[model samples]
Target: MAMDGKARSAKAALKRQAMKEVELRHTVRYGIKQMLGDLMHWNKISEMGEALQLLILNAVPESALLYRNADIPLMPAEMIRHHARQGIQDRLDDLAGQMFGASHKHVIELLILCAHDAGPEGSAKHLRIPRHEITINENVSRKLDQARIREELRMGRDD
Candidate 1:
């Protein structure tokens, strides 16, 4: 009985010491710390990133810039949990790294761009942004045409 009591007190002391260390670590305001936390916390960030990526991919132009930039497909939560068990977590951080270093501003910009492009393209109806009239200069238009022709020629050669 005495030994058990001693062991319990030792364990309690160790836990308190560890918690003190955690408190000290969090005292410094580090920028954008995405390291692994508890499972629920990690899942929350992962789900948000995955959900945004899914929504962006589903909306507009199909070949829009956001769709292109949102290259990583979101996996089901069960699959993510399974992968986490295997030490392959942090899909959210990976998604952020791919999406211009995980800057929320960039993600919002892409979403806004999608909204602007999709308004007329008829992919997303509810979202609307003021369509800015873009005038392509003659030089830019010619260069774009040349690139299109070169791509066609390459495709023909491939065939």
Candidate 2:
């Protein structure tokens, strides 16, 4: 009888753990989806600050709600900005070989613009190019600043 009770208890514990894992996965998925939706909406309006705030809010449900209620500060804008820049930089590094006729400066600016225009997933696609023979200009660095500024302005982005 005691052995049977132990077996039952173990089964119950396993069931509880499984249920908790499923709940956690659901919460994370919901959070990510909510954040993505907010990002898309804010992108259209060009309200970067608000968009970042929404992202932070979605990332942490309880904290975000508390912040909304008590007016406590949530995530920092600089952290989000840094994350976005780092994401762009990593993508650029991965696609360094595929960028055609693009200088390092141009690549940096293009990455920022692409991140704003396409988000992280879309920016990944934009960075992918057909790998083939390409010419590297000897003066790649000479016009980098000019190209970067030009691309930034053309894409309606600053930085």
Candidate 3:
């Protein structure tokens, strides 16, 4: 009987140790998942900002020139600020569709700053910027054409 009691106590101790290990594993996995989530969120925001900047630079050569020259006047700055605010608002509205959580607001703000411009195109109606004006840079125009071709190829592949 004494031996049996000792064996039972040992079995219970082993079970407790197993439970503790399982808990530790779960905690570690949770931490890793959270870190990955944050990293992915940051990457998405960075990519969006890059794409937006490319769009803005390609859309408004005058604004891009001002930025490149670091000679943006007060009027241009105000217009850029207004566009940035609008971009933020648009991002917020589309957040739910993008499956982004609360932390994404900061990311959107960062993207807005990188993509803001204040040229004639900025004042134009949405989606109304002339393709000729938007494609002022020959290199950017070639790249845009290539991208369109690639997109078309992808769509064809899907079919």
Candidate 4:
């Protein structure tokens, strides 16, 4: 019983220490300090202020851009989640990575990929073609012309 009490006290101490570290970390002037702490942890940012700035300056702006895209979100939840989870996970994955046990990953991916700007004809990074040569059917075209000329001459001769 004494050992259990000691372990419980140790765990409580550790939790308090963690909370203190978060509080001591560079906090943004923004009102959402706890959210900043979560963001810092998620993005591997050592300072909470930097994470807050990132959310405000970078993540929000990028989502606004996606808001205009009108092409990625197959369902309402995808767009909602992307806006909810403000981080790099969405940028890394078309489905914007899993969140809250949402099951629309595959559908969102399809919608993003099928968008006009996302495929090979647009923003695709790597593209491949089977043949490199650009050739016209000169020989066949020449033969067809010759046949037409001969027939025209034959008709003239008959006339």
Question: Against the true structure, whose TM-score is highest?
Answer: 1
Query: lDDT of all the models against the reference?
Result: 0.39, 0.39, 0.37, 0.37
Q: What tens-digit string does per-residue lDDT give for candidate 2 at 67-134?
A: 22222123332112212333333443444444544443333333333333456555333323235688
What TM-score against the true fold does each predicted structure earn? 0.22, 0.19, 0.17, 0.21
The true-versus-predicted C-alpha distance at residue 13 of model 1, in Å, is 35
So what's the TM-score on candidate 1? Answer: 0.22
The digit string of per-residue lDDT tens for model 4 on 1-159 reads: 256888997896787565442222221222224333443444455753343333332222232234333433233231112222333334333333422232333322222222323333431211111245876698988999999999999999999
Report the alpha-carbon TM-score of model 3 versus the true structure: 0.17
Query: Which stretch of 10 consecutive residues in model 2 shows the poorest summed lDDT?
Result: 21-30
Ranking by TM-score: 1, 4, 2, 3
Candidate 2: give the clashing pairs.
Answer: none
After TM-score superposition, what is the CA distance of residue 136 in candidate 1 from its true location, in Å? 52
Model 4 misplaced regions, further than 4 Å: 1-135
> Stretches of candidate 2 above 4 Å error?
1-41, 44-90, 101-104, 111-159
RMSD (Å) per prediction:
20.2, 22.2, 22.3, 23.2
Compose the digit string of candidate 1's lDDT tens values, residues 20-48. Answer: 42111111112112211221142343443
Q: Summing lDDT over every window of 10 consecutive residues in candidate 4, give the lowest-scoring window.
A: 122-131
Q: What is the lDDT of residue 12 in candidate 1?
A: 67
